[model samples]
Target: MTKPSNFIWYELMTPDPDGAARFYGAVVGWTIPATRDPAAGDMDYRMIGRSDGGNAGGVLALNADMIAGGARPVWLGYLEVADVDAAVAAIAADGGAVQMPAFDLPVGRIAMVTDPQGAPFYIMAPVPPEGGGESDAFSVTEPQRVRWNELATSAPDAAIAFYKKHFGWGQDGEMPMGELGAYRFIQRGDVGLGAVMPLMDGYPAPVWSYYIGVYDIDRAHAAVRANGGTVTNEPMEIPGGEFAMNAIDPQGAPVGFVGPRTS
Candidate 1:
């Protein structure tokens, strides 16, 4: 068992699932495979496959009702838990709010939740795959896998406290961001997951953004632009000499990428 507090899965909710599939497939080198799960019923759900031949996430088509209710395309992360109901209860007690009540699908029991600062994410207790094992979609060292999870929040300290209390996350380190406050690194045990930082003034609402690993930054950046996506920032070097860029997919979902730079 990998314990109750790790990020185990990710998903994208978009109005145009087909367009999103094509855009992300080229930008991140993922293979979008049509989902055949009987549990999916009549809804259109697709899987995001990594370059190394494992599932990275899923693309969920936004229903008419969801869009009418003001739902926009966004990438959401799912944190694994042993008890979904218990976790939701704890979140409510800690001033957090529920976006979707807990429900069961063939894969797991999941609840959509937001932190006290209003950053949205999912809490799930997944069923083991048919062969009975967990998937390695959250690896930090694997290429084309989700490498980092970042939370941009209005209240960093309070957000950190909520995650720490529910998910057992701890402060590994911090980087001062001038007057913007500190970027606090969060980790589970020794594995560095990602960081929590203050949301910039002009950015959208508080949200969790994930960074996926790629083989080459320059090439990936090119693909991003060619596929109708928007790179919001110039590729910048990070702590490990890897380069990263923030971008919005063709359907307007924000995401990040990290990898080697091609000179």
Candidate 2:
């Protein structure tokens, strides 16, 4: 079984899945392999594959009904849990809201939820793959994998508390941002997973943004712009000599990229 509190999956719910697949495939060198799952009925799901032949994440096309119901294109992260039902109960009791009730799928039992501050994520009890080894789609050291998860929330303190209660996350260290509050690094065990900070002005809502690893930040930035996406922030060096930047995909899904830049 996968360890609880680990980020097991990442997904892009986009209005144009094919376009997204192509855009990301160009930007990150990920391959979009089609998946036919009998459990999902007639829906189309495409698996994102990394260069090492491992599955990275997935792209699910948002249907008309979902769009009409106010669903927008966005990237969502899923944290692994031991029991979906119990986790859901704990979340509710801790002042969170359940967006989608727990349901079984071929991959796992999952429920969509938002913390008290309204930043959404998924809690899943995943089933092991046929041959059984862990998936490296969301890894800290793997190239082209998800490297970090950043949360922009109104209630940073409460959000941290809720995640600590449910996911066993602990504060590792923090960086001070003048006039913006501290950027609190979160860890699962000894591994630093991400950070939580105050939501910036003009943001539509509280949300989580993930950073994908890339070998060449310059090339990735060029690819993003060439594929109809816009890089909102130019690549800048972070503490570890790695470059990071924020961007919006062609479909307007916010994303970040981090790694060394050859140029």
Q: In model 2, which residue pairs have backbone atoms overlapping below 3 Å?
A: none
After superposition, candidate 1 runs with Cα above 4 Å error: 1-4, 34-38, 130-133
Tens-place lDDT digits, model 2, residues 1-263: 23438888899888887788789888888987555434567876777778888878888888899889988889999998989999999899888999999999888899999999999999998898889876576777766799999999998998898888889888878999999999999998888898999999857789999999988999999999999999988999988888999999999899999988776
lDDT of 1 at 181: 90
Question: What is the total number of backbone clashes in candidate 2?
Answer: 0
Model 1 TM-score (2 dp):
0.95
> lDDT by residue for model 1 over 1-263, one digit each (tens)?
24538888889898887788788778777887655345688878888877667899888888899899988889899999988999899898888999999999888999999999888899988997778766677877776688999999999888888888889888878999899999999998888999999999757789999998888889889999999999998799988899989999988888999899867
Q: State the C-alpha lDDT per candidate.
A: 0.86, 0.87
C-alpha TM-score for every candidate: 0.95, 0.95
